[model samples]
Target: MPLFDTHCHLDDPRFADDRAAVIERAIAAGVERMTTIGCADTPDAVGRALDIAKAAPERITATVGVHPHDASKLDDALFAALEAAAHDPLVVAIGETGLDYHYDHSPRPAQQAALRRQIALARAVGKPLVIHTRSAPEDTLAILRDERARDVGGIIHCFSEDAPFAKAALDLGFVSSFSGIATFRSAEAVREAARALPSDAILVETDAPYLAPIPHRGRRNEPAYVEHTAALLARERGEAREAFDAATFANALRVYGLA
Candidate 1:
């Protein structure tokens, strides 16, 4: 079955030396489509994400938005710059932005503001949003509802929330994307969350270079590893691997808005 890694960070410096090889390995492993996220306001990072998409337009695509950790950097000029790049023929979605109260990397207000602005941008540009919410599910849901994120639709990337949160997100027209973390033994609750998700709302990712799953937890992650996550997700749902793979792949396509 064809695989779609709904979220990854192929632009992270970890792959600078052999990004092409990474893509090749992904394709060889049946990952036909992948999205490398760009921050809403980080020009340099987003710029690199675009170039990666441009270099392999057929396989790699990207989304531009300010991540919650760097939300403090957003400004009108920054959004304007990102707006200009919205239709660059590479950005497929509008965010990796939202609340992250856990680290408080960026001020909560800044994160919320950046998220709201990107939600508007996504609506304006008719692109989906890629949300990154963590340890602040209630506030994230509040903001998403306030901004009517359902209008544009998107996925909660690398989701680690509870079943209720997942259900709430699904109720708001959002798809729940599980990452490599779902494959970890300690991630039992997360696996249950994945199982509890409606079939159509379930998608998968590697979030590479970040949450590598079992068998490769301490090592670097890549798109190819998404398959392992997918398999684990399939098992958790009590469905056949091939059937779950096909269903999740379809869900990924729909969330990505791929034609």
Candidate 2:
């Protein structure tokens, strides 16, 4: 079955030495398409993922944003660049932006401010969003609502929350995208959420170079390992692997507006 890795960091330095090989392996392993997230740490680097997507436009798309960790760096110049990049055909979404209170790499206020601005940008550009919420569920949901992000909808990428959270996001037009965390032994809550989510509201990702699934848990992650996370979700939800894969692949295309 073909799979879609809805969220990944193909631009990460870890893949610099063999990025093409990584993409080849992903294709060989059945990942037909992937969205590489662009988290610009500086004003000038905003189009990093778009450059990668340009090379493989048929199979890859990109999202551009200021990650909450780098929220404080999102000055006017960076936001303007993000505004321009959002108009690119290869750029399908407007984030990977949201609250990340867990690390506080950027102050909570700055993160919230950045998130609101990106939501507006997503609405303005007529694209969906790719949200990254960590340890700030209430605030994350609140900002999404306050900013009227439902106008554009989005994906709650790397979902690590519970069933209630998934339902809440779904109510606002955002779907849940699972990562390798779904395959971990200690993530019962995530598994429960996965099982409870409607098939149409689900997606799978590797978050490459970060969360690698079991049997390859300690190794560097790549898009190829998304199959493991999909398999786990299928088993947990009592659906056939082919059916589950097809649903997620289609769902990703739909949310990213490629459908």
Candidate 3:
């Protein structure tokens, strides 16, 4: 059952009190690696994961860029800092960035502009983009096409349940990632997409602190829960969990350039 979480927000305040304990618990649960994203507060005040990665440099990995809700924070100061900080080896990806029309948290234009800038920076820095798209798939893909994001390459993070959208993204050479949504009773399409990916094309994320799986539905998710989704995916493919995990983890590492 050894596996990787692929995505999480150990920085979120919920983990602040016993974050180390949580990581230890996950490790004991056989979760091997986790990506701590850059979509946090101001660069200086990012939470424990980045702080730990900075101090230890290997226990966790991280990405750079602002989340849509925080797009306004991608101002010059944050942009400049992200550019400088992204060079760190601990940082392997450049986003969690993209459009989020569901919440319409930030102005759509602002999210679009930030997405473009982060894409450019990711290309310049030679890191994979950690994309986050929701309810704005058309424009999200549109912007990526317009910005020529294929040159940089990245994942369609926490992918939409729509396989037509999955096919469209895969056609662009982007990896499709599934989160716990795949385990939802109502997410047959998402589950099927996970099963249908061609060899070396699928990845899974917890989107942790959110979207926990069936047994833990509506609960706060963490990296260890990735295995549950992995189990379901493996079952769908009629393969053993370990082999499926190996393939999916390899796909994620390849996508994020962890190798």
Candidate 4:
């Protein structure tokens, strides 16, 4: 089955020692393509993901933005760098940017400001967005609306919200990309949301180096493990695994404008 891990952090320190091996494993496991997010907290580091993508352009693409956790660092210089990087041919999207109230790593105001700016950046560059929202659904949706993010659309990476949130996001032109969290027993709301979404509005990801799925729940995650999340979604929706995989792969391509 072909798969697309629509989100991951291939540049993360965890993958530093074996990034090539990890990509090899993903391809061996049927991940045909993956998007490595470029979340720079500093201006100088903005090109990290682009460098990775450039090395394997056919199999990898990248998104550039400052993560919500480091929203405070998105100053004029970094934003300028992000704007320049956003125009790179290998860059398919403009974020992993949005609100993260769970950590409040940056203040709520800063997160919101960063999200608004990135949404505008996405519109400016004619690329979709890669939103990372957690525990701030109302505010997240409000900001997206206020910023007119629907103009460029995007993916809600690692969707942890419910059906209503999914529906709301879809209305704003954002598709929900489910991650390993969907496979957890306690994530009933996520499962329900997965079941309820239209096939085209749903995509799957590993969000690797983080939410590894069941049976591999406690282990370090990589692109190869995205299949477990896809399997869980297929079973939840009572769809054939092959069909689900194909649909999600195509959805990722469509959302990223790769198709």
Model 3 segments more than 4 A misplaced: 46-49
1 or 4, greater by TM-score = 4
Per-model TM-score versus the true fold: 0.96, 0.99, 0.94, 0.99
lDDT of 3 by residue, 90-207 (tens): 8888888999999988999999999999989988988888889989989988888888788878888887658777777777667888888888888888877776778687888888
Query: What is candidate 1's lDDT per residue for 64-102, written digit by digit as tens?
Result: 888899899987777887888788777888878888999
Over 135-199, each residue of candidate 2 has an lDDT whose tens digit, in order, gives 99999899889989999999999999999999999999999999999999999999999999999
- Candidate 4 regions exceeding 4 Å error are none
lDDT of 2 at 211: 86
Candidate 2 vs candidate 3, lDDT winner: 2
Q: List model 4 lDDT by residue over 207-251, tens digit each.
A: 989999997998999999999999999999999999999899999
Candidate 1 vs candidate 2: the lDDT winner is 2
Residue 74 Cα positional deviation in candidate 4, in Å, after optimal superposition: 0.7
For candidate 1, which ten residues in a row score worst on lDDT?
39-48
Q: Give the alpha-carbon lDDT of every model.
A: 0.86, 0.95, 0.81, 0.94
Minimal lDDT window, size 10, model 4: 206-215
**Which of the predicted structures, 2 or 3, would earn the higher TM-score when compared with the native?**
2
Error of 4 at 212 (Å): 0.6
